[model samples]
Target: MFDTPQSTRSGATAPPPASHPTLPADRPGPHSKRLGYIAVIATFGGLLFGYDTGVINGALEPMRDDLGLTATMEGFVVSVLIFGAAIGALIGGRMADSQGRRRNILMLATIFMVGTLGCVLAPTWETLGVFRFILGLAVGGASATVPVYLAEMAPVERRGSIVTRNEVMIVSGQFAAFVINAIIFNIWGEHDSVWRYMLLVALAPAIGLFVGMLRMPESPRWLSSQGRDDEALEVLRQVRSPERAEAELAEVHALALEEKESQTGGWSDLATPWIRRLIIVGIGIGVFSQLSGINVIMYYGTQLLENAGFSSNGAILANTANGLFSVLGVTVGILMMNKFNRRAMIITGYTLTTTFHLLVGIFALAMPDNSLKPYVIMGLVIGFVFSMQALIGPLTWLLLSEIFPLKIRSFAMGVSVFTLWIANSIVAFGFPPTVSALGISSTFFVFAALGVLAIIFMWRMAPETRGRTLEQFEDDFRIQHS
Candidate 1:
């Protein structure tokens, strides 16, 4: 068989394609700055996504008290939104294809507003759950659309870093949630509805995203696919230097033409062995990311810490550290994206995370159930978050965005992310019961086991996309399986 495309080659790979033009380090270019502006605007969706999901971490206990939630009901409260998110991801992909990335984000922002409003106004547990599910539609849509939007808008050479910015924003949003939750809780001190204030804080970012995205350009790749070549070129020129814009537009347009010529049907095209293989890889990556059980810390950190023996106030305060370290980790991960191999970094993350998982379990099993135990376990949890955010979290989204053929990219992302949310929903819903039955030590052991399987999956199926053009990856997929 022909040598695998140099871009995806394991070692001694060729450099990035020429279409990914670079400016001198001494001086920043207008084009890069413009691209940065667009990225910042689009990633507000990620901020909203993060805040909406994470606000519940600290808010849940108060909500439980307000709504009189039982353990099963609490699980339902958390997991139901994730289930809604799965549907949102499914629909968001198709919407991105039909509605345009810009429009879909605008719509998601509106959904965010509506969801937040509903939650804030929710007077009963049933209504609160309904609104959380509504909020999840926006969260899931943003999750499905934002990365794909960034990937499509980005320069081929800068794709990894640019797309991963959304990941950073996601973590940043979570950090913001934790900080706000702490502030509100500390100030209000067991007020019956403190969670409402926390939920309401999300409205600011939702409004910002809606307003900011109005001025953002449509994805050039999406435009090309729609036969709007002139519009596509204009969007490219706004984000790229004149020469590079022309060149990249040519590449995108040619791929668009090829897609049109193929006459392949959507969804059914996935049945082909090669496309099926890609979906499997995509789904595997998506599922594995969640199975890492990082959300245990993200969603129910307070409960976990309380279980480990911290008081309620102590748990929320300590959870802020988790949020802080998460931002630091994702920031480091973003900086490292251009500097390391994707597969190696992700595998290392998995290895480290799995080790931490086992260590946490081992400590839980061995430690006395005393004051010292929570601190030690918290340290382990912090390390796990650091490792996860730095590697698998960002890399998983980046891979999912780039892995599929462009023709079905959004749809495939939806499907992949839908599977991811499904996994997330299962974990979120099951965690309380699992922890109740399995105990914290046993719970982490299960996660560690999943991490081991994740390593195997990455080794066997994950492709290296760094330094490769999306077009090149597309070509590689076709050449290898055709």
Candidate 2:
């Protein structure tokens, strides 16, 4: 068993805590305001992530017409970004680990800008798909890195809320896309190429993230891992209260020093029992989060509305409600993250979302040809959005950020989110065809069944990370291995 600063299962000497110099009573150190600034900047990556992915929902119709896309081709276009995101999550995690979190996000900003421009300017379907994949790289990178950055930087007590703020932004971005799509489509709905304007909206935020992150401090936990404790402490001083900063740094320093003896930040480390178990849980969180079928609503809300018998314009406009409530749900999620148990919230969300899915499916099946089906389906869709964003959506990203040990946090997160993207890709690619074959009722029923399985997994496997330090979680896992 490895020794840690805290008492081990095998009764070893607990290392003494680090000494910190006291400051004057009048001198206040860092506060939540600075942290909030950092969060705002970092979550821009999330915002861009949301807008880029969500833009496709409304743009797909115009894109299909302009590009003469078959149903298969449209699905391919939508799913390709997810497939690229899978690759991005994998690569971005490793990059964040080796290159530092701040540096990686800056890089992602550049990629977002270039990829967005490429997509906006693409002259052919092949080119658009390729650029979307490029944008996927930025999206995946942001997904893996931003939450880790926020989680590592945030105080333990407030970590859930702070990290999950990115979810709020992500949904907010999607909301913005829906609103923009509605306005743009209303004005230019007759034009086959109006989608280009929608795609261009993301470019400004990419630039903002790139510039804003330049002034932000590096993640103290990451610096600690790199043997830059002094730098880490300084960064902590910028974001946390003086006492809290010292305490957090103390924990980070201890872990960093202990792990210094033997580096542990790669795929090979997964061979050990505890690390393997942790990653499996991580993978489960990632997979089940997507399996909740939230993205079906996200990526195909307009199409789903149209399928339910709304006209094209009616469907696009109705999606605005989806976007609005998603923002509301995530806002509620941000408020509740600090108050609720992570596992309980996720389970509750999955259960409710699954029920909603079943209801939507059953309703659609019962009234498959009724004139009222569209309105009823719209209400159910709104219910699904509320259920998902408030719980499963925010909590998924929160848990993924909090679950892994710092040593392998980024790498493990990459794999977990990679799994998420894969599940997402499968759902995205399959949904078009599935809906085509089985109709709305059966499609949602399939999602509802998956949601049932997600609840069981959350109940049995997911950890409670509500009130613990990164080092505390690491020590607990190490003790389990011992």
Candidate 3:
């Protein structure tokens, strides 16, 4: 394996790659500002993922009332997109690996437009569900692709912070969805097509992503894999400063050659012990992230609040609080991410969330069934959201982006994220029924048990990957498995 000279900054030794050229401290210039814009554009996919998944929380009830949906249909509508997302994640991963990350994301942007259009125009619940599933395909693909794209292109110093920005955008998108849902519902409270309007707002960002990505560069790492080093260098120069970009491009090219000579790029590559172990770790992180039941809160917070005793409008308004807190939590987490170790964050987050779940379950069970009980439980639920957003939420995506080798980064993350969506689908599809049959208290207790398992699994399997470069971490992971 080729190794680049290391530089120690703030107690962490950075691997070969320097800070991205554009943002180098030696000279602050226009390139730095432009790179920041590019990061925002790339993260638009994350925004759409957040908004599309979260809109269902407030829109589902109106949609149910409008289309006369039953419990099964309700679950179907909510989870159908997750099914499409699963397939999209798998196919998008392969496509991102084979095609280019930028191209695949642009294609996803178009799919987002189509899926949003379908949902907006559908006259029946069946049609809306189908459209939602289609939308999910795009969302899943974007979720898998965007983070990898960001991770691959980001400089070593900023990788965690940059990749987690996608998480921030995701929660921001969810917050936007909640706010939009509330505003639209409040204005057109009795309108027949209010739900349709809720679904349509996603188109604006979908269009923005499609247009913005047109001017963006492809992943330089992907280009290097295809033996297009010159193009890769040029693209790197666009994002990095000239000196650092040249140095980083050389390092990337060297690694590409090493990986090419080994020819370990696919299913067969995974057979190697080190590669296999990394893949297992990658998948474990993805599964544990979903097993936290965060999506259950995002997709069904309104309904969960309603079950806790809030009225319809009250539920919608209260759910907006969930979205806002989620965004806030993610912001706080991202700020702390660069400052702390990844393993510490994950362990701390899971511990707090598990404690919240147990407390919430106990509070719900013990509190009297008065109006105050609902508000108190809702407060606990909000606390749970805060805990999740602040810790596990961003850390999960950050770790997935960090753990894999470059040769199979897209494929590995795709498979891992695909598993995440599948896990998400299971929680989403089963949550309503679980609540109905087992009641909210028992349902959360089950998640609490899962959370405890996640904590143990993480402690045993997850590495401290916060400040390491992808290349350096790859060597460490290889040694660990060996």
Candidate 4:
């Protein structure tokens, strides 16, 4: 086991590989300035990812009305996209490896555009589902590709901040979706077909990503891996000082040579007990991440609030608060990252979120039929979202990145995130009928119970990975598990 570069939006646990050469620090030269511009352009993929997923929060109601969807159909409509995402994520990771990161991203952008156009013009729910599945392919692809592109392109010292840009853009994009939904719903509240306009919002960034990436250079590390040292050095020099670019190429070249000896592992690696255990841990982390019920709010928050007591317009507007608090949570989470132990943050996060979930269920069931009941429940749900995004949400990705050894790191991360999406699909698909049969109060009670289970899982199974260097952590992990 060896260290690999992996981190969450917080950029925690982002130490460069010990086996690689030291990278140059970020400089204030023209090349560096241009590099910042390039990063901004590239992370448009993340922005599109957030909007496409979130626009459905408010759009689902209108979409169902226009398409005349049944409750079960509603569940499948939402779940199918996630199922596609699961497969897309795995395929996208491999594409990133075999194809250049830049090429994969460019292709994903086109898919995003096509998916957006299809959804906007979809005449039937079945047609909508097919296009949504196509969009999921793009979403999952961007998820797997964009961060790697950023990490590889960024200066070693600035990788944390640069890679983190995509995450910030993601949350901000969700907020944008909510805001746009509210505005559109308010101005055109009478229209039954307003949802088409909501989904159309994603097309802009998808176009931006495609256009902007045409000017971007290929990843230097990837170039080196493919035996194109001259091309790699040229790309690096455009983004770094000439001397730094030359030095980094030698290191990248050396690392590329080392990789040939330990080529990425396959199914046989899973036969090894230690690797298998960590793989289970990786998948478990993904499972717990979704079982926390965060996406229930993300995908269904507008409808959830409508059930709680808000009017159609009020619900659409109020859901913006969830999006807003998410941005806030990610902000605070980033600040807390440097200070808190990741495992401790996760445990405490689960506890707080569980408490909030319990409160939401309790208030919904026990509160008198009054306006106050909705407000009280709304506050509690916000608490859940904030605590989730602040700790468990980002930490889920971080832990996935941290747990796997270098040899199979990409494979494991892809598998785990795929599980996360499947878990998400299961929850998303079941949520509507569960609410129909059990009501929102009981449904939340179910989530609360699941939250308790997630807490237990983290306590017993999660690794304490804070403060230690990645090599030491992986070594200790291997020995302890063995």
lDDT of each: 0.87, 0.86, 0.84, 0.78
In angstroms, the error of model 1 at 172 is 1.2
Candidate 3 lDDT, 246-330, residue by residue in tens: 8777777777888887764678877799888878878888888888888887888877888888997788788888889999999
Q: Would you give me the overall lDDT of model 2?
A: 0.86
lDDT of 4 by residue, 1-482 (tens): 11223443334453443223344454578998878988899989989878988888778888888999997777667777788788877788778777788999999999999999998999899999999999999888787677767767866445544665676677788899989988898898689889998998898899999999999999887788788999999998899888788877886677577656864655678977878988888888889888888888888888899899988777866788999998888777766654555667788888988889889888888888897878888899999999998877767755664566545655666777788888988888778789999998899889889889988887777776544333345666777667
Report how far residue 455 has shifted in candidate 1, in Å: 0.4
Give the CA lDDT, 0 to 100, for residue 451 in model 1: 94
Worst 10 residues of 2 by lDDT: 17-26
Candidate 3 regions with alpha-carbon error over 4 angstroms:
1-27
Against the hidden reference, what TM-scores do the models get?
0.94, 0.92, 0.93, 0.85
lDDT order, best first, reads 1, 2, 3, 4
lDDT per residue for candidate 1 within 168-224, as digits (tens), equals 999999999999888898899569998999999999988989999989999999999
Query: Which runs of model 1 end up more than 4 angstroms from their true locations?
Result: 1-28
CA deviation > 4 Å runs, candidate 4: 1-35, 155-158, 189-192, 233-255, 401-407, 459-482
Indicate which candidate wins on lDDT: 1
TM-score, ranked from best to worst: 1, 3, 2, 4
State in Å the error of residue 410, model 3. 0.9
By the TM-score metric, which is better: model 2 or model 4?
2
TM-score top scorer:
1
Q: How far off is residue 235 in model 3, in Å?
A: 1.4
Question: Higher-lDDT candidate among 2 and 4?
Answer: 2
